[model samples]
Target: MTRFAPYLFSLMLLFVAACGGGSDQQAEEQTADTQAQATEQADDVRTIEMVGIDRMKFVVEGEEEGIKTGEKMGDYVLLESITAEPGEELRIRLTTESTLPASAMAHNFVLLTMNADATAFANAASKARDNEYIPADMEDQIIAHTDLASGGETVEVTFTAPEETGEYEYICSFPGHYSGGMKGILNVEG
Candidate 1:
C-alpha cells in the first residue's frame, strides 16, 4: 500500500492539472465566442436603400429625378426622417446611373454621425480631390461611406448604428452635389 501511494499522488496531481488546463481553454473559447457574437449582433441594425440617378436623385420616395426641396425631380428622401431603434445596424447601398462619362458624372454615399455639420463635411470632401472626395481630416466624423461610383456602378456599406438615438445625416460629397440638395438624414431612436 505504501509503495502505491506515490503513484496515486502523481495521478491526482495530473488530473488536477489537466482539469485546470481544460477550464482555462474553455474560458478562452467562451470569450472568443462571446466577442464574435457581439460583432454579429452589432451588424444587424439599419438598412438604408440608396439609389443615385444621373438626374442626381435618390430612389427613396419612388421619384426619378432626386430628393430635395427644389424643382420637381424626385421626392426628397430625408435621411434624418429615417428612424431606427437604438443599437440597431445600418446598411447603406449606393448606386449611380448616368449616360455621361464617369469623370463627368459620378456619385457616392457618405453618412456622418450626429453633431457633424453637413455643409462643412461636404466642403471638406470637395477639396480632397485625390481621396475620391473623402476628407482625411474629418474622417472621425464619418460613420460609414461608400466608394465613388460612376455611371452604371454600385457600391454598399454596412455598419452598426449609433446607440444614441438622434438625427444622423448622409450626403453625396460629390463637389456641388450636397449644396444642390443631395443630402438625407438618418434618425436613430431608443
Candidate 2:
C-alpha cells in the first residue's frame, strides 16, 4: 500500500492540473466573448446631424429651399418638430448662422424631460449665467443639452431617450429666446 500511495498522489496532481487548465481556457473564452459583445454594442451607436441657419430655422432634408414652412421632412429628421420612440438613442447637432459674435447671438439645444414645466425650466435657466444658462440644481429635469454655439459654429450632444412616452419641451435657454418662440417639442411615441 505504501508503494501504491506515490502513484495515487501523482494521479491526483495530474487531475488537479488538468482541471486548472480547463478553467483557464473557459475564462479566456468568456473574456473573448465579452470583448466581442462590447464591440458589437459600440457599433450599434448612431449619429444624427442638424443645421441651424441665420434665419432661425433648421434644415431637415433636401436642399435648403425644399423645406416648407410647416411639414415633416424626413424620418428621424426634425426641422421644427422632433419625434422619437421611447428609449431611443438621440444625437443632436446644432449649427448656428448669425453675423453676431458668440456672446451676442449663440444658440443651443436644451431638451427637458417629460412632466417638466417648460416655462419654469426656461425661466430658471435664464438666471444661471455661469453654467451657460443651464440651471445646475434642476439637472434632473433635463434629458439632453448641447453646448452653446456661435454664428458659423456648431455644437452637439448624444443621449438616450426617456423610457416614457410623452411630449417633452426643448428651448434655446438663451435669455429671451424662449419667449421669442425658440422652442420645440420632442414627442416620444408609445
Candidate 3:
C-alpha cells in the first residue's frame, strides 16, 4: 500500500501539470483569436490621412493640390470635408507639418457632435492646455479627438460615424488656430 501511495502521488502531480499546461494552451489560443479579430476590424475601417499644414489647414493625403485652393466656407475654408456612410467605422490620421516649435504651433483633430458649437468649443479648448487643448468640461460635445500633434508629429483617432445623416464639424483646438481657419466638416450620409 505504501509503494502504491507513492505511485498515486506521482500520477496526481502529472495530472496537475497536464491541467496547468492545458490552461496555458487555452490562454494562448484565446489571445491569438483576439488578435485576429482586431486585425479584421482594422481592415474593415476606412482610414483617412489628414495633414495639418503650417497654413492652418487640414489637407487630405493624395488629394489634388488644387483642393487646397477650393471655395471657402464661412469664416474658413474646407480644404476637404470627409464623406462617410452613416455608422461606418472611420480612422482619422492627423499629421502636423510645421517648422515652428510645438509651443508656438500644434494641431489636433477634434470631431464634434452635431449639436456642439464648434467656435465655443474651440474657445474653451484653447484654455485647456493641461488637457492637450481639450476642454474637459465640454467633453460631451466631442465625438472623437486625437492628441495634439506637434511639428513633424502625427496622431490619430478611430470612431464610428454618427448614425444620423448630417454634417459634423471637425477642428483643431489649438489656440488661435481654429480662428485662423483650421477646421473642416465631416458629412455622414445614409
Candidate lDDT scores, in order, read 0.74, 0.73, 0.83
- Alpha carbon deviation, residue 42, candidate 1 (Å): 15
Ranked by lDDT, the better of candidates 2 and 3 is: 3
User: Over 4 Å off in model 3, which ranges?
Assistant: 1-42, 64-78
Q: What is the full ranking by TM-score, best candidate first?
A: 3, 1, 2
The better candidate by TM-score, 1 or 2, is: 1
Model 2 stretches with alpha carbons more than 4 Å out: 1-46, 53-78
Cα lDDT tens digits, model 3, 1-190, are 8979989999999998877755777899999989956965768876776778778887653544223334543333346677888888888888888899999989999999999999999999989999999999999999999999999998988899999999899999999888998888888878
**What is the RMSD, in Å, between candidate 1 and the native fold over all Cα?**
12.5
User: Model 3 lDDT vs. the true structure?
Assistant: 0.83
The TM-score leader among the candidates is 3
Candidate 1's clash total is 12
Top-lDDT structure, candidate number: 3
* Candidate 1 lDDT score relative to the true structure: 0.74
In model 3, the clashing pairs are none
